[model samples]
Target chain A: MKNFYKVGLMLTVSALLAGCGNLTNSSLSSHSNGTKTSKVTTTGTSKSGQYSTLLQGGEYHTSAITGLNSESDSDNASNPKSFEAGLLEISKKEFSPDKYFFQEGKMISASQAQKWLGRKSKNNPEGLNPEDNGSTDADKRNPIYLQQLLEQDFYTQNDKNYDLSGMTIGLSMNDVDYYTKEKYGAKFETKISDEQRLSEGREMANEIVNRLRRRSNLKNITITVGLYKQNVNDSLVGGTFFNYGVSSPGQKKVTNWKNISQQNQVLPVVNDEKPINSNDSEDFSNFKNHIQSYFSNLSGVTAQTHYQDGKLKGMAINITTQFYGVAQIDSFTQFVQDAAGKYLPQQPTIEIKIQTVQDPEAILVKDYNTKQYSSHVFASY
Target chain B: MKNFYKVGLMLTVSALLAGCGNLTNSSLSSHSNGTKTSKVTTTGTSKSGQYSTLLQGGEYHTSAITGLNSESDSDNASNPKSFEAGLLEISKKEFSPDKYFFQEGKMISASQAQKWLGRKSKNNPEGLNPEDNGSTDADKRNPIYLQQLLEQDFYTQNDKNYDLSGMTIGLSMNDVDYYTKEKYGAKFETKISDEQRLSEGREMANEIVNRLRRRSNLKNITITVGLYKQNVNDSLVGGTFFNYGVSSPGQKKVTNWKNISQQNQVLPVVNDEKPINSNDSEDFSNFKNHIQSYFSNLSGVTAQTHYQDGKLKGMAINITTQFYGVAQIDSFTQFVQDAAGKYLPQQPTIEIKIQTVQDPEAILVKDYNTKQYSSHVFASY
Candidate 1:
């Protein structure tokens, strides 16, 4: 019995290790146009039968003021007439690049990045300098920084026309490679497929566009949904993680923006032996369920449109219902089916980005050794 | 302008009822105990003080038992022993009665009283003798059957070692007059104060002795505390109230022993309007304090003891200290000069009594008109 128990334990551990290995090699990619296409197979049972009839064929329109502009101009353009007839018509059906990547002048400060990553450097290391100058290097590719930059750009560019009232949205699980390196002092191999990345990105972009179309200015708004994938190496640690795109309303001028400044960046220690695949599927499922539940429970969400760049993606048939003394969306499952039934045969995709991070101080060194850090990081931006 | 308006209104009223007088009187007595007691005193700068030290005496030993008969015949009779010792030595020290009246087992059914108070020649006009017939009168007095008898006996008993264990107590403001009228009718007014003619015989004897000694087992024990003054018809109604005494462990036998029939007697309800000129300096001080604040914050308490022959009386101090924290009392203004400064003046006290209730149904009639109820009634007793 003892030997059998030991063998069973061993098998479980081996399975977990295999899952982690798969995650390391996984490759996911997103198109520059915001479309996500993937070829990975899902392990879970499909509920595609529910998506029999989906909405399709919608045109996307762009606002006259799509680049970086002051709040006053954005407000003027967002007036009822422009918002309903012009700005809304354009931004409503399409996903804009300026809405997902950082604009030139809106990058976070080095101190802010350090606080998020839980580390400190000597000086601001911006541009090509990589001698721990306390600023981020423009050439360096930091996936975590890129994720934050995307979030900021998305909010600034789409906020005026989207009417994304009363929602909490943000990018999460960014800079996994950097965090892993700093905390674990060990490198991880990516296993996500490129096909999966593209699909996930498209799905996310479509969801965001749909959400923007149903906008109302009566509540707080948040919209976060996308995926990306990349590799981590010493040379890419100091480079800019997020590339600035077209600026939009409530944004600073591109001329006054710093060049890929490492203003806000922090290196957190990563745990070397901490297994990440123990419950990956379960974790993802839970995350998806949480998002669906949140949307389903919201009040006054009448309609939604999905898109990728300038292309119209899908639309959701929002049904309001009262339950437990509050107004709520009946079900996101129903919405997804009504919005993207034809798109279900293809596997929805998500991208995973990885990067190496160097920590000058041993601030989180003890935490890494103790295996106290959680694998999935949740970023507000 | 005011004269013209008044003249117009007057002419209208005169046209409606020219012959009706404005003055009128209702049949109801506004001086009922409940109504008069609810009135708030508007006097300014009334001298306020609390009851003095609660002497440890009377039935203290019997009450130490947590449950009914739990400590029966136990070798560790520490409680009973301490109570006896305290009562014996109370006179040497400066100690105040826990309250003024002893209400133990004064409850008696009208049927039970028929043999003692009802004359053989007396005939019920409606041929409904409550004693012989199964009537609601017996049921009405069910809750008070034991308390009234005890109070009457406790006041009349003179024995210092009166063993009043195994008796219950109750209280009622209307019992005395009810029983008196039922027995004597019109002659009640003339024979009420006569020691021989009064229903409480030996009990009154014992109580009178205790009152003379200024140490009553009746202290701090009453289910209800009421204030009354003689009206034009020489009937009881609400007025300046004072605290009543209750039976305690040391004075139980003396107050409620059934073998001593005279032990069931009640003290007269003293009216505050009547002048009190006691030779003792403390009497005047007590009267002043009692009139101002004693009744304002009276506490409620319940005590259990052995009842014998349906009579019980005793006193127990219910001390509850309010402190901002565990270390300090909230309102300790002056330290007691005596007893190594261990005591404080103006401490809260609650007098409870178990007296024979005349209208048992009346006990259920709470003064719902006021948000606060009389705190003097011993709820659980």
Candidate 2:
């Protein structure tokens, strides 16, 4: 059944990719060869005493507590290690038959999926790595990766029966032992709402299917930039605050926590695998072409160019969306200067022309095309 | 002839007094009983020769240059011997028989008058009594007094037949010697104009009259009031700047020259003999009475009063004169506490009710009556 589901999911992904236009040339032209990777891991234990048997069909539990066992266990009530150990023992006693599945009703046990996913650990043979135990560096870790991995695993188990649409995503992080710390250390924890986590898993699966259908490099593929929590009082879930095409180390990076809480201007890169090329004319051209294409795609939009001293200076992009119906890109001269100051491409006076967009989807294609691209469109007051 | 003239002068004075109200209780009540006399003596050739004979006629002249020589020899030139010698010498040279009588066929010389007026001298005279010569406090001596004495002699001699009404007075005291010693010494020579000299004479006479009128037993009656020489461009004369009534020795008085220069307030008293009893109800009542009397004496003028906080504050004296037909005392406030917090009485609050007068005497009488007698007349602004 699991093998049947895997085949179905691949076929579905193939269908989706067939409908998408070829973007390989544009992507290839813009990006360099350099690639970087980030690894994230998680660990848990099943209810059964036998590791292989527990993987087949059972409920699982993970110890939430961290770093409490190594110290002397005087009045063990204060130690989280004792509590976690106790909870683990209780969970281990409760045995129920269950299966981990990639797609709906695909019932794949840990023993069956071990080869395709990754090798199981010899010490703790449920295949979950012991090192992938808990959250650390709460602000830097990405929640989307975990959600995507879950979706991918589910799709591998269940193929055609699962629907990834109509799902939402919720991500959060905090330090459980924050008050216990005497110094600046942050003992962080994160919780994703069940509904939101499911939604994110489905969206990520859909993205992967799309990438596979298009025959694009899986390494180069990017999921939708998720909605970031603005601040404590913000009612809306997701909104695009910044674009991520412009890159720098501290410039655009996403984490488990929201940018708003950090009081930081962060732009989460949609395509992190793509390398930035400083010397390539194709890269500059691609940037220019992308900008031009963005302007052309927008309908009912007006482009206006600014000039100073008889020289073309900058452009303003005015957009009329449903919520922020009238929005403007004040001027592009400064941005161009910041982006292209060192390159000195043609040494020509760069001017920008704004193109207003009623349907922003045409200009910001990535936002509409991605499955995880749900946004809370706000109404202008 | 001198006796005959003297007798005639006495008769004329008597006639003038008769025209005025009798020295009955009404008038006598306002004046002091005791006489205040400023006695002077005569000396030089005027005591012995033809010049002496001329002195009987109340005039003197140099018979010959030899008499001039003896007189000049006797003249210390630096320090005048006595008031008598000074007067004799000055009168002989500066005043002649013709000068006194305004004789149709004769002319008087300036040299004769110069001797009596005394040359610019520094030589201290022998047997010069400090009191008589005015040489002890000579440095502090007021030139205004000497000038007044000279004017009195001039009026006594020359204007014996003329009424001294509607006469203008001008007074100037530059302390030429002191000024020269400080700035240019004996090198400075002042060329006195006839008009200037004449004006000085008139002012001297007016000062004498004013001083005589204000005869209080208090030696502190001596006031050094700054007299401003009006520019030729100015249209008005006979205005008081500021006056410091009296001072204890070695004390700083006249500290505020600017306040005096901007003479916006005036305090005129009727009788300096009595102490200013500001706290006494009768004293204020008497003051009001005097003001009313003064106002009544004036003709074609009106008086008004102002009240503040239900208290009789000030009086306004309005006059209708020829030049400025309807002029009102712009401001008049009594019992004002000056900047130094000194509670001075008889601090006259006077504003010239009229700019110029066709019938000044009438206006003057009206103002005097209103100011002194009427309690109802408040300050004019």
Candidate 3:
């Protein structure tokens, strides 16, 4: 009986890893995916003969994979949020919220992820990073090739359970790798050139995809890969997914890699090259000037602009005020809303975070698709 | 020279603890404080003769005392946020953002807090809770009194540094204490009566205040104490600050306790006692129905209402939608804003969290001090 049970478990594991059914050209269209929305017309129903429910429920099935929070100390505060949001945004192109439910990565184990994130060594073979060369010099010499690996899984509802239909993996590479000279010594950094970073990222992503294809459960699922160059340690904005590629089911590796032209710049670009769009800067300047004029007690007013393909896609403005009362916050929020409508571009999404030195005061936002702005002021009592 | 340095350190600590310059009746106004906003006539400056700056700069000086994240396993998800926000809210009455800068508690160490939270025993003389009876039965025979302790310190600017002027402490008493009969055994709960909970919370607060007064750094600072009753584990909303008291500078114990009639109720309340205000329920129901009529794809539309002294204060509505897309989310958010404006009372602060099965879609809010509503829809790239 015990032998029969062991055999049953093995068969189940094999079926989970090997099963690939109903692969079509349309299902493979997520390949070569970018942020561009190309409308796919359907009969108002998914291939499963049901209307795709965008996140049928709000709670995501927690990751079956462990060790998500293990290497938290090594992560930048911005990397985790930006990496996950960007991946889900990218995945929407192929999996579409209408069709797939979201879940944290389950296929990769902690040991597997740790190995891939480490320097390739003779003793350990699964390392995707290049082998380290012993060097003390950091600025222009030896650099850590990889920083972190994030995985997100997309699922489709089956008869009783959700089937793993697609996966998105994000590889965060370092622009400046920080290392210590000796145990508990001064920290040093090695700057990675753009060319070296992109090339290494692409190479590692391809190798990772090829490797996962060898696993039975990972053999026939659609895989999307994004390569991100993490921002400098002191940078205010997080890094972007600079490049992406996709591997279709039954494929061995990723191909046709596309460069994503996305950049985040602090507004009032000083001591730097001219912004990609002069109009965006001018509008932001006008908006800032208008709010600054209305309120003289403001600590600071600044914005971070997001550009895609050299076009202003969004701007998140931070307005720091010295005021505390509900009356003061409400009045300032009203004026800012009016200023945003008058000065900011209507095509790009705009967000304004109103805050004090102690806590968040209010938040105002405008969606790209609509002219109306939405806002919320926190309650004090 | 080493002895001289030691003497200087002792003098500095003595000065920090015993500095009681300019003690007056006006400075003691923070005593017997509540949510009531009784306007104080200010000469455009604080007692220090400095124009009160509400969090002068946006960044708060982090906590000097450590052990904040310890015992996180014993905390409820909502308790941390509510406790901190509520304490800050209570502190605002006395410390006024205009006068004091916010900081995490500096006087109380982690070990001291842990000691106070444990059951009083001969081995641990500092424990504030009742000594354990060693009974196996949890429901009627055994009970745990306290759950967690949180502290916030407020500071006033000095010549070179911010002087600690006031401090607030939150004692989170459990409503239903969960315990295990044996190691890794089945969990059991002891339902505490309102009389037992409040009486124990008051006693602990008094004991805690007296103990804190003996410390050098904590002795002269004005201390505010709030007693909070944590909600049941399965409840949707967090607990409320049910009572508060204050200790003037140089006082040893909290006195003149005031009952805070604050309660949070889920809207369209079912199988519960009559709501504190019928108008609030009607407004929420109308708002929910109106939005539901406009958006049929919503999974659920519910609200949590906050009341104080039998008067409606705030309502946080969660609109879970099945829709995905910029156009759909924007439209639904617009409709929610319209319905909120038409249905919800103008005096109460209103917040609407628009979400999908996967991620946040948008947010709409109305400040109690203003009629205009603010909304923001999440940008999906």
Candidate 4:
């Protein structure tokens, strides 16, 4: 029994070392002999119609499933001596990357999916995304059907003048899991780039938009995609979201985007192993504390720090006093700015909001990193 | 050597099992036979004259140091058995915490610390926060001294009418280590209610604040304290902050607030163990996806989600269309709200913002958690 288990491990390792090609493609095919041996495959739904072929059951689980029968368990139950029939199972995610699939820059609502899917078609009356009538153990995630439905919807929202002559839309259910695992809830927000894959995200967005433009959506619609960071501390709560695309009303002939194999170019800014405690970051933190302390000594002023990567991203100070003249405001602003410049080893971002009777409201913003300074004084009586 | 290590292990366990008073109080006093054994101590600055008494050197580290006397014999010819006199050390953070110390919400300027400390008051001439002149091995952190200097500075910043009659102010250099270890710099902010004694944070805050107000500052400065969740995926940054005292234009003759004996009541909301993927959290996550999908069917709309404690906290949706009337916006908002109300197992906060030419900017915010709803419409040209 021990030797047999060791063999299972060896086979799993062999399959792992031989990535992408052999293990991913081969299924139910015999090796040297015509022995009906089973290999744990990533595709849960097998053409052979035997659910046991999945080895780890239907769930997209984490970690390895040990001592699992790859073939039908009926024979193992009848023949207790057949312990060699079991195979080790490694999850698909274990062999994959952090990103799942591309999400649309614009979120698609449940009603839209249902309505588009329910659109009367010759193929069937009830729409595509309907609940499955199959057994609970069946593979429930149907990526292809959803992709087709989305494409059809995009077609419905466009016009022939835009010309989506030759675009085959594909859907990937990968983002469904991506959303729940990386984000906080059930909301599907493809527009969010929580992982900081903006350039790559833009590539995907362009691919979709360019294709849709060819199709017929808005005749002259130009969409600008933006990816913003999520504001939650927990991985499940936030990742990223899109600020909703800005649309310029117009139709233009589009071209020059290509769909590539699951390969992406942009990467995450690999944070230093000890980001918070790194010397540079610590300096920034100390700077913030000292600045806050210094500001406190000054009368009628309060400041809150906004920090990122252990550096002082920005400082917002509120001053409560009526200014006698522009010179006074300038002097005070320069004083604070000079102090920040002197103390910080790096350029600092400072924002000042002032309140006074003559200048009822005013704001001064300085971005040392960008070398840009902006100030506005509201004129009011 | 192995037998000696075994004995050391047993002694260590004995020390641990004995708990605080026995292990903590017994430092230099001779053990059993007075073999002149060494013990690890928390004071980064040891009075043993050999500043190198700390085997780990001078780094302000996190957690306890393990193992000691690692130098090879050839180098320690003068005291070959120096190994016999060494012990493992645990830094202050690693040592047990009775309570998190109160951080002065208002930061003090270096000049102020220098001035009050440099006063010809016989006790200090160079100022309390002067750069260290002693050798590097001395305890790098000096909390007690800083705390005292801070008290003096506060007196300088306040009015003379208030009797600082019985006030004693102390500065905790606690923030220095906190900034370095948790963040990246020397800013001191220690509201750390360590995981072990979370119940004690509020106690410390109150203890520090009550004493501070009585210290001849403004007599009636009411400080507003805010405890915020630090947003970090690693689960550390978030804590609490103090919004400096509100003086309401003039000081009131203050009275009644007391400095209690290290005891108080407020507690942290200890979340359920598996907050990230609780069934309820997942359900909410899925519901979010479903809602986004549903909302997609509607024309001109988008939503943002805010969640806490593995549950939906609030969902804010924005509609981009010119509403013909309030009734139209209400109908659409109600439709989305009703769907959330029906599916969510718990009350969900829902906020909706709509744009129309007549009322280009309008906001409808609903706090289901607090059972409050608000709407404001800005007049248009």
* Most accurate candidate by TM-score: 3
Alpha carbon deviation, residue B186, candidate 3 (Å): 45
The residue-level lDDT of candidate 2 at B188 comes to 30
Question: How would you encode candidate 4's per-residue C-alpha lDDT over A231-259 as one tens digit per residue?
Answer: 22211111222222322334232233322
lDDT of 1 at B215: 31
Model 2 chain A: weakest 10-residue lDDT segment is A372-381
Off by over 4 Å in 1: A1-381, B1-191, B195-329, B333-381
Highest lDDT: give the candidate number. Answer: 3
lDDT of candidate 2 over A129-176, digit per residue (tens) = 122323444443332222101111211123223221111111111112
| Greater-lDDT candidate between 1 and 4 | 4
User: Per-residue lDDT for A1-381 in model 3, tens only?
Assistant: 111100011011111000121112121122212323222211111122112322212221233332243211244555555665666667776677666755556577777788777767897687776666776776545567788787777766443334567888888888778777777777777778899999998888889899888877677789999988777766667778898889999788887788888887777777766876898889889888866754677888888777888878888788888765443455456556656766778778788888777656777776666667765665532
| Consecutive 10-residue window with the lowest summed lDDT within model 4 chain B | B1-10
List fnat per candidate, in order: 0.00, 0.00, 0.00, 0.00
User: Could you estimate the TM-score for every candidate?
Assistant: 0.16, 0.16, 0.50, 0.23
Report each candidate's C-alpha RMSD, comma-separated, in the order given: 34.8, 44.3, 17.0, 28.5
Q: For candidate 4, give the lDDT.
A: 0.28
State each candidate's clash count: 164, 70, 9, 42
